[model samples]
Target: EPEVTQTPSHQVTQMGQEVILRCVPISNHLYFYWYRQILGQKVEFLVSFYNNEISEKSEIFDDQFSVERPDGSNFTLKIRSTKLEDSAMYFCASRGTARGNTIYFGEGSWLTVV
Candidate 1:
């Protein structure tokens, strides 16, 4: 079975520092997304990417954030400057088709900003 994989499952960073979370989605999946869950909050959609361009994004994905697929296989989320509010479990997800299709989520990459 295909699944999404994330690297550096745990990361600790100082406030105002930069951080990058990496992921590899199922090979045949087309839609990719980034979602985050703050310690006690619901999972929130950050951004979605398809066809090499941003398809949708939440207000949380502001100027400090960016996503890129440097290689066809790897997707990366970069935060230019982190804040205490940025600490959360970030999940990388993908789906073969659309909303009705099954979406695969990677084991979250936990980011801790001090």
Candidate 2:
């Protein structure tokens, strides 16, 4: 089975700075997503992409965040400005058409905003 992969496994940034996290989901997957888990909290959905466009996003994914599939294989999440509240482990996920919506997640990109 293929797995989602993420770059810069960990990052530390100052508050109000910009950060971009990158991922490569399983090659055959059809749907992609971004999710984040704040320290000691449950994972929260951020956004989902399908057919080269954003299909859905959560309230927590406000103006400060954006997602894109820059190429056939790369999916990225950009935080326009980081905040202490944004410190969390961001995960990249994907699911194929036959998986019954069972998304597979990457190890995660841990972000620390000071």
Candidate 3:
């Protein structure tokens, strides 16, 4: 039962700084995604990648964001400049084949920008 892993379950940062969140998705998974929940807000999709390029990206993935698969098992999300509104629980998820199409998620990487 291998699962996705995200580092720094929590992070606190100033209003303007750089932050890099890391994740290791399941070994055989095909799709990788980044979703965020802003405190009490609903889960929002930031981006999804497959075959080493972006499949889809939501409006929230603005100029300040970037993602990478630096190795066989590592996925990373980088934010060059943070803002107060950037505080959220960032979840790394992988979609796999079940009986049908379904997506699963990691616990999350929490970011607090103040």
Global Cα RMSD, each model? 0.9, 1.1, 1.6
Per residue, candidate 3 scores C-alpha lDDT tens digits across 56-82 of 999999999999998989888999999
**Which of candidates 1 and 3 is the stronger one according to lDDT?**
1
Tell me the lDDT of model 2 at 24.
98
lDDT of 1 at 111: 99
Cα-based RMSD of candidate 2:
1.1
Clashes of 2: 0
How would you encode candidate 2's per-residue C-alpha lDDT over 82-107 as one tens digit per residue? 98999999999999977477889999
Best first by TM-score, ranked? 1, 2, 3
TM-score of 3: 0.94
> What lDDT does candidate 2 reach at residue 108?
99
Q: Estimate every model's Cα lDDT from 0 to 1.
A: 0.95, 0.95, 0.90
lDDT of 2 at 78: 100
TM-score of 1: 0.96
Q: In candidate 1, what are the lDDT values of residues 1-114, reduced to their tens digit?
A: 778999879999999999999999999888999999999999999999999999999999999999999988999999999999999999999989666798889999999999
